[model samples]
Target: MNPGLLLPSALFSLLALLLPLLIHLARRQQQQPLDFAALRWLGSKPKPRSRFRLDDIPLLLVRLLLLALLALWLAKPVLHGAPDRRTYVAVMPGVAATTVAMQALPANARKHWLAVGFPSLDSDPPADAQPIASLLRQLDAELPSEAPLVVLATTQFDGADARLPILSRSVDWRIVAGAPPSTPMVTALAAPRLQIRSDSAHRTQAGYLHAASRAWQTPAEFTASSAAFPNNQQIVLVWFVSDPLPTTLLEWVAHGGTVILDSSHALPQSRHPVSLWQNAAGIDLLQAIAYGKGRLLRFTRPLQPAQMAELLNAEFPQHLHDALQAPGVAPIPADARTYRPQTGANAYPQAPYSLQPWLALVLALVFLSERWLATGRRGEQA
Candidate 1:
């Protein structure tokens, strides 16, 4: 089992341990040698070198310990335990409670329950998520490879998507006929007036873009060139020839207008470096670039008409709409996206053990002791 930290990178805060050390060193005491004639003559022979002796040892230790505890607490350390080799029966999305009511666990196995990333059924209800192949793959990786998994879900879920990710472990699945999970209704606004520009060579791609807009009940006006900026704040989505970024496009992005750069066409070398967003398996699928107050987004996948016809997924329109969503517009709430995480936490649950509360208690105790040592004496005198 691998140990994990909730905020692993935040452990760098431990470097602040030096702050207390520096304060203690700065509180140096300087003693002046008295000009006593008799004492001077007696100590004229080089006095025995004094070894390093520290004053206020308790106070210095308390301060250092306090800082150390705070850093540990902030790190949110967790210890992962090995999975209990259990023969668990998991009910998946759309599985009827009546169907799984009579299932019993074998005596050798620890338990049988729902496969909602939890040990029991009484915990939080699992989200009826899509791309179930991805979820199954993750479960495969997390659980022990040897443990047998019996999954009961619906046939509709099994055939939900063709892009099923391969799982590490073999699963014994029983598919039943049942209704599919309900997709949440996303109330996307009728898009603002959009201007489309494309080269003659990429006309088909531009046509598909226009079609997608119309599918959402918003029609776009096509233009031969995007040289003329719209008086109204309308977005310009472009698929231009690569060698040199056109003057019109650059100006549009610079002046706080959003531009979605279609990656199907090769782009010329750009001087400004942009970091890739939403990278998976070392492949960066999306990149967002900030240009002045505006932004530029580049999708690494092609959105050509041929590709759309052959293998169109829901990604194109969703991606396009997100790039167009600028500041102060009727912003789409992030949770409204159907495929996003339920808790917006890590994909895998963290290990059970946490050091945060324990560390906090230690910090509190050290602080109280330090306060007592520093101010208790002063208060008594007063």
Candidate 2:
């Protein structure tokens, strides 16, 4: 496989040839005087011809050729094939809702979706849902023969089947799950529960203001309400069950704003007609929505500060930064460059070599060669 190692093998082959030559030369260098005392015994016994003969040139050539071939094989010759280069686009849906919704989509849709993006979702979600393994088998039927898939999720998952979904035959899938919960930060920033005001318009304008005011004061309450739209940060809306999300949210999402709604709350009930805007891409956005090009993501659960940091660092950093940078959106500064792939590289594992069989073949060849040389020596003695 590697030509650089062949030089040493060639030298080894030469050494094999030189061993016999050196032995022959050393024999010739020694000289002995003839003794008359041995003449009677030498005459009585039939003189034995030399066991080694220079006339066996063809056999010597064959042995040397075999040694050279064996050495060359040991050097590990390999033929390089064409380089594989292909670009792929991935669409990762968030956990549970994504896992179940994938089953509901058309078989062709599942195949097309997995072919581009990561296949597996996080193991767990904030809400109750089916396991990832079950989802994988259902979606496996639609995956592409070969490509790279990217995974996006609202939460990280851990389970027996944790590998990102990709076909052993062709595709390579990389998983990118959302940040997990942080206990300390969640405890510190925990929002106080507020009484649900039946006044819909007031709730829309300042739902958490009254509760925040009770803990702090009137000025603090006014400041918090005014500061709801932070400068330089992308605004992410998390809608729950009690308050119906307005259609204006769609305009925000369409413009690349991050809006997360809980499926438990956002899904339609018998009392109200479920809005079609909520089910973008058939994945209940009430579940989660991550806009790839816009660099924006929306999730239902309020994450801890550490979890939030992990999301920015590991998940969709590009979309996150893009959403933050647009003045039309928010003023928060985002680190967009995190978790980028290496330049000119694909996300695939390299193959490993197992050399036991090759070593066995070499040993067999050495044994056969030694046997042939021994047989020739025995024939000469006979």
Clashes per model (N, Cα, C within 3 A): 0, 15
lDDT of each: 0.54, 0.35
lDDT of 2 by residue, 45-110 (tens): 664544445645545555666666566666654433333323332333332344444433323332
Q: What's each prediction's TM-score?
A: 0.42, 0.28
| RMSD, every candidate, angstroms | 15.4, 19.7
- Which prediction has the highest lDDT against the true structure? 1
TM-score of decoy 2: 0.28
**Residue 326's C-alpha lDDT in candidate 1?**
34
Model 1 per-residue lDDT tens digits across residues 83-163: 666765665555666665555546665333343354454444345434344445556656665577666666543212112
